[model samples]
Target: MTENDKPAEAHEQDGTQLARENWERYQYCVSRGHRDYTRLASRLEGFYLGGGEQWSREDLEILHEQGRPAYEFNEVMPAINAAVGYQIHNRMDIAFRPRGGDATKELAEVRTKVAKQIADNCRLHWKETEVFGDGMIQQRGFFDVRMGYDDAVLGELSISVLDPLDVMPDPDAKSYDPKDWADVTVSKWLTLDEIEGQYGKDARLRAEGARALGDEDFGEGDDDGTSRNKFGWQDTGRYDAEYAGGGPRRLRVIDRQKRVLSQMQVAIFPGGDVRQLAGDEKPEVLEQLRANGAFITRRMMKRVRWIVSTCDALLHDTWSPYDRFTVVPFFPYFRRGKTRGMVDNAVGPQEALNKAVSQYVHIINTTANSGWAVEQDSLTNMTTEQLEEFGASTGLVVEYATGKRPPQKIQPNQVPAGVDRIIDRAAGTLKEVTVPDAMRGTQGPETSGIAIQSKQFAAQQGLAVPLDNLARTRAMVADWIDYAITKYYDSERVFRITKTDPLSGKEVEEELTINQWVPESGGYLNDMTSGEYDVVVTEQPMQVTFENGQFQQAMEMRGAGVRVPDSVVIRHSNLTDKHEIIQQMEAASATPPDPLAEAEAVLAQARARLAEAQAERARAEAVNKSIEGMFSSAQTATLVAQNPAIATAADGMWKSAGGIDKDAAPAIPSIDAPAVAPPEQNTNPLTPANPSVGMNAGIEGGQP
Candidate 1:
């Protein structure tokens, strides 16, 4: 029990000797002569101090004593025998410890337990044999049992339980037994080489190669068809035969990192098909069914179903949560069934929608092989004007009806010859022409002409004509027959005049006599002359007939019964040459002058005189104003005098005003007149008037 005293059990057998050597080696490797031996030595002491146990020197000594028996047995036996009963099992590929507390014994125990677990859990239906040493002992072994636990092949088995004897030891010589063993069954076991081989299959996991068994053995084949064997296995028959036949085998290692499972689930239900549940209901019902989920409340089943289905189909390909949910219905839900739900409300009417869709389709077809078609309902509920506008956008012509008969068409060549006359008659009498500019020339050119003429005639006659009068008269008289035909017969009644005679050429002269019955209100002619004739009574009777053709006549029948006979007779006495008198009378007759021509000539002469007088008066006024302004500004006067023409004109004016004498006329200041210098007698006879001095004074005293 002393620190330096070797355990008596250490020399008991080869197993005990081996255990002692291993313990010494472990202690030596960990200590390295360090002072912190307490912390380092704790693990080899075989009990966790803080987890579930406290340290006691006596208990430690007992544990050492108890381990001695298994140690002695281990020292006496070969190392391979310890693995005889072991099997690999479980998902972690670990094994159980031996029944004894000996370190070597425990190692063998772990191997044996692992092998047994593997044989118990795996579906192993094959056997293999290996002979040893001079054919002395031959053994055929069947491993990896055909039976499996919970449908899983046992890959590895691990034991974690500690023996009570490992914590405490007996003083007497005794065999040790482990109380309990923690067992773990692995679904797979992989050596570093196997893991590495898997990594070669998929280079993405190359970093995990160290944990694979097959990867350690993978290399170029040798001449014997055997490669390097870097990994050791306890059981491996569970894999398929193809996988087992290769010199070096590989097992697929799924990436643990990539095997992520989402904890949340999203289900889509078709609109109103979703079941309504109260707060007390279980959510599991909705979670399980395909028809019980939706983010929106459904009022209409079919529409909601379509929307949800669309969303589901879209989300099936994308992995984002954002794409999985539908915020609003795919088709807009307008409360009042009005097509109003658009991304931008500014796109106002459904007609605009139709236009937009049409344009979009056109663009798509032009740019690509898209077979888009425009639907009429896209312009639902649009007015006539809106429809026309929409049609115009796509270069389509539109026809709108006013819900009445279409307008009549008029022809160009079929216009009546007498349409002008008809229009004249109708417009003059009826006054019913109100055609607009577009209708005027289109209805009938001759008809329009007749209308204009009729209007003119009515104005000349000084009569107020009713609108329908001329139309009625024209229709009754069959006037404008061709125009009527054109107006009534053509599809598009647009009339054009092909040829026409000048209106002036169509004029006719006709004399019309109008009798005026005046009731005491006398009438006077505007422009007329009176003529008087002198008759002489002779021996031969002369007779004359008078008529009221050119003058007003009055007949008086008095109480004396005086009668002015219709025919008057006068008798002439001496013989006279009647032919000579008739010739004289014929020679005396004269044609009257054209009064209009005379008036026009007189007006022209008056205009010419007035124009000449205006020009003369303008010149006189301009000259007078210039003269008056000249006295106001000395500069102006000086400027005028400097020019020869202006100076001459001024001189003429001064003379015309009877010369600028101080006594005879008011003083008119002259801008260019030299300043009056004091009289200086000429000292030198050659210096006449001292012109240089005067010129110098003029230059210096010049007005600005």
Candidate 2:
């Protein structure tokens, strides 16, 4: 046969064989991975619901299990919840370590912008991963990352998380990063409408699907869990024909060529064909699809999809230009333990503690709430119904009976005293193992705030395990995202993100375009021209240290009576709008104090009073002088009246007074003065006898 013809024949054979083998592998993986896991699922479900799965008929069959309330006294939920108790979610920071050396100023800016874009994407997808991580802790052993195009984003690139339960791996894989793998598939339940919305009416396989679907020729799917396991993921759907009708989801199998995912194919369950069909295609086109990952459906079987078009070429499978798939599993030791037949390998002592607490809680509650049967004297109680009614009612009522003896009451046996201690210890241990006490805000109000903060810091340090794992997982996804951005973002595009302003150290919006990062700017592409670069991953910067440390410093400064800038204090606080706050503080400080006019007014009042007092004394002295003059004038007038010359003499005296004549003293009755005793010899410094040589000499002689 001709070379082209030989490939066509080989293609048909590959299609049939691949379908059978894949269906078998799917069944095997279910048996090994997810089927036996119903028990684990039950435990995880109970942990969240606060008790084991509701008591079933199977549970009721055993006399010991009846009347148990699934009262889920939960300690597991708290531990799992606290494990990721971060005030901030996006704690990761990315820096590109260029091979040659440091980058230029412009190049550094570009790299920083690039890091922020990736970080923004991580932040967008991170919350979901945390949720999945909780599940991974509870039941699912691990979670995964899927990087793809997001139309909602400006850059069109985004990241996503995958539940571990949604994925099925090759049954015989030895390691996480195996040298080779046959295949891995991810499945999800979707409604008919969603399928129609995504794949559309055009997705109908045409006449070929009608001819091939449920055809006896292709062979049946492996329905058994042993020979060929077919348990596909957590079904999530009620399999109801009505609401939430997305049952039996089409699983997407990522088939590999050598090591990388070269194509994508859909799986078909063992059921009648419900797929719409299209017009026939040439045998040559059909043959070409068989060689690739394409398949036709059969009842309880797998299928290779082919397109019927004018051009003799395969479609869809090759549309994904990303030669490598973006899905990467985060199971740290998935490959290692699975080989050793360890299911739920990630379950540690913490899980055991969690289960023990759950069991003990059930026992205690059941003992008190349900197991305890009330009893009374059969004659006094009379009817069983009446006794039940009395037991159920919360209100207390009593009926006095004179004839019969008072009814006797009997209570059920009490649980051991040690049960409370055991329960308390288990809860404490769970907190210790998964989440620390400090992280949960369980530290009492009486605890010192600083001491509590220290405990929190220590607890954060202890959480290094999961945090580190998170960093590592996110870093891997980031590497792929970086690669995708480099390859797919050929055209210049702007990605706007909120970034921390370098100088201000505050968040501000920024935009980075493709040209800003690639060859145009001296960034990854520019650096690559010189030498390759490495992706260095770091957990999101711990602002706790910056925040709490600054806060403590501020508080101490306040205690020390130091003048701390209001803006500086606010920076360490929970307040927002630092720039606005700083501006307000600056304005307040810039404003001058109100002038001290009141003090000036008081001083002015005292000066005015002194001036008024001086004026009053002057007026009184003038009045006294007037009175003296008037008295002298009256005496002169009386004498002048007796002698005609008196009036003339007064005028003369006024004239003489200017010339040297003085007015005679107006006399009153004079009394004889007692002679002063001779002054005793005095030692007054001012009146020293020998003035020149004594203490008062300097005053008299200037210097003796």
Please tell me which predicted candidate would have the highest TM-score against the true structure. 2
List, residue by residue over 273-342, the lDDT tens digit for candidate 2.
1321122333533333343234544332122221111011111222333334445545422335242111
What is each predicted model's overall lDDT from 0 to 1?
0.27, 0.47
Off by over 4 Å in 1: 1-200, 204-704
Local error of candidate 1 at residue 86 (angstroms): 20
Q: After superposition, how far is residue 68 of candidate 1 from its true place, in Å?
A: 11
Q: Candidates' TM-scores?
A: 0.11, 0.58
User: Model 1, 1-704: lDDT tens per residue?
Assistant: 56237564542233334323433332342243211322222221212112211224464476457542111111101111111101111011222322212224433332323233332333221111111000001110101111112332321221111111111111121221110111101112243365444334333233232233233323223111222223534233334334676443443221110011233333334432232222222353332242223442323211111000010011011122111111111111122211111111211221232233333434433333212233333433454446544432544443334453422222223333454444334333221212222212233555655465444333323211211222222221121121111111211112122222222112233321112223576531110001111111111111111222111232323234655332211111122443344344445554566899899999999999999999999999999678655544554354454543445555566678776555633233334544444334444534533343421133323322
Candidate 1 residue 22 Cα shift, in angstroms, is 34
Number of clashes recorded per candidate: 80, 21
